[model samples]
Target: MAVSTPPRRASRAPTEPGSARPPGRGRGLLARATLLLAVPAVVVLVVFFVVPALRLLWLSVTTPEPGLGNYTAILTDEVSLTVVLRTLGMAAIVTVVCLLVAYPYAYLMTIVSGRWRAVLLAVVLIPFWTSLMARTFAWVVLLQDNGLVNTVLGAVGIGPLRMLGTTAGVTVAMAQVMLPFVVLPVYTTMRGIDRKLVDAALSLGARPVAAFRQVYLPLSFPGVAAGATLVMVLSLGFYVTPSLVGSPQQSMLAQFISVQVNQLVNFGAAGALAVALLVVTLVLLGGVALLTRTRGTRSSAGAGVAGGLV
Candidate 1:
């Protein structure tokens, strides 16, 4: 009757601090590593980009007696205003041209298999591997009087088309040089699209053109915006291609800045021009951002509806 077994004792499991990660412990480590990697990049950007930009801004106001002299020159001087306008105009034209040409090529590339796509991509990227100066020089050979283009024109009974040292020449040269920048981005965006969605649209009685317009184009807007912005910005700063292929009257802001710096020996004016160009680029980029935001909202809304239906 007194043979009752001793009550078994229950043991609790021991918990280690490492086993129970305090809420965001993993996130903390990731954040720390990200910061560690970013610090050097941030430092370099500050040292090189931010510092130089501030110095340029300072020079724009401070030169030839400190008090808005350079900025006033930008407004009052007809030559400066003309150069600014021309640069903006050319940049706009180039952006539009690049978009029009790149879209079809990008769309075609997206429809092909991966291996074929890579080959096409290589073709697009090959020019980048070559020297930009050499590429521009090659254009000179192609567009020069009695060169390939002119020879072809002559054969067609079109008297030698004077292409060199013309705005047309500059546009053609700049467009060719900047095209890949446009194509790659559009191609990348297009590649991310679901082929099934387009097929679904077609299966639902939507024509191919309608499917593309309704489905694909909206998805590709971000890429189009990115590529256009890139080409336009680069076109704005173009010096070599414009100088070699463009007329003296076609001199862009970069060429104008170069003249002030090297020939006129006016670092102040050079800095002023640089600041003006920088401001224009910032404004254009801001405009692009605004436009993209508006379009992106619409695209997102449409996508949400489409996703729900699917």
Candidate 2:
């Protein structure tokens, strides 16, 4: 008893290579907490977005004898076809214009410093904080026959030209509002590009423009793609600015949907039109997503190859 040995230590069980450990209690609690925190947002989204969208979808098929007559009518009707085409055409124009305008401005932002850069960014973002109605009306004032634009033109010996009540007017207004969306994405991409790469190209006897085209432009393309997709989609469904500054003939998909619902009281037609616009939007976004995914895959593969070579 006096010389009793120390109690034998318990041997720990060994875990096999594929054996799973018990889930951490803290991790489980954290996950539950995160789920609890997200419940409110989920509820709000379901109540507002999901519910209304589903209602619209249901109304599209069920209204006017629960048939696809409205869709058939949309396809066959000349007026509907014209509206859709005009919407698409204007969206394309606006997207292109925004891209052209944003690229240079974004490049400027990447080059500028301190206060000037801040000011440029502020200018890009200012429109978002302002009222949409105010901006639309401001465009109305500028584009109206005798507004500021015409006044400036008159001072230069050019007579007043009609800008308001035209497709061009709508495009201009849409571009003004959508410019920030394009600029920000491009600027973000430009900022992330390694300046040394361009410098290296310059040092290696590459011309500035050539280096930019071969090196900088490729890196910035994803941003351009993103911005163009955003601007195009927004322009497709634009209502306030287009309606305020554009003629009846220049009405977009949103205005058409509104007219069908408000003036014509054709719920079936309206719902079908809405559904058509939604489908087109989704299709476009899906195509953009596929393009982006392909670009990312190629980029990753290229990176892996370069890494392996290194």
- Predicted structure with the largest TM-score when compared to the true one: 2
Q: Compared with the true structure, what per-residue lDDT tens digits does model 1 show for residues 100-139?
A: 8899989889888889888988887898788888999999
lDDT of 2 by residue, 1-310 (tens): 0111111101111112112322335567676675566566566666865576667667667777797877877777888877877777888999999999999999999898878999999998988789988999999999889999999999999979889998878888889999987898778777878899899999999999999998888878777877887787678777888889998777877888889878988777777777777667657776777766767676542222211111
Residue 221 of model 1, lDDT score: 73
Report the error of model 2 at residue 271, Å.
Answer: 1.3
| lDDT, candidate 1, at 30 | 75
Q: How close to the true structure is residue 104 of candidate 2, measured as C-alpha lDDT? A: 99
**Where does candidate 1 have its weakest 10-residue lDDT segment?**
1-10
lDDT for residue 285 in candidate 1, whole number 0-100: 69
lDDT (0-100) at residue 22 of candidate 2? Answer: 28
Off by over 4 Å in 2: 1-29, 300-310
Question: Clashing pairs in model 2?
Answer: none
Which residues of candidate 1, in runs, are more than 4 Å off? 1-43, 301-310
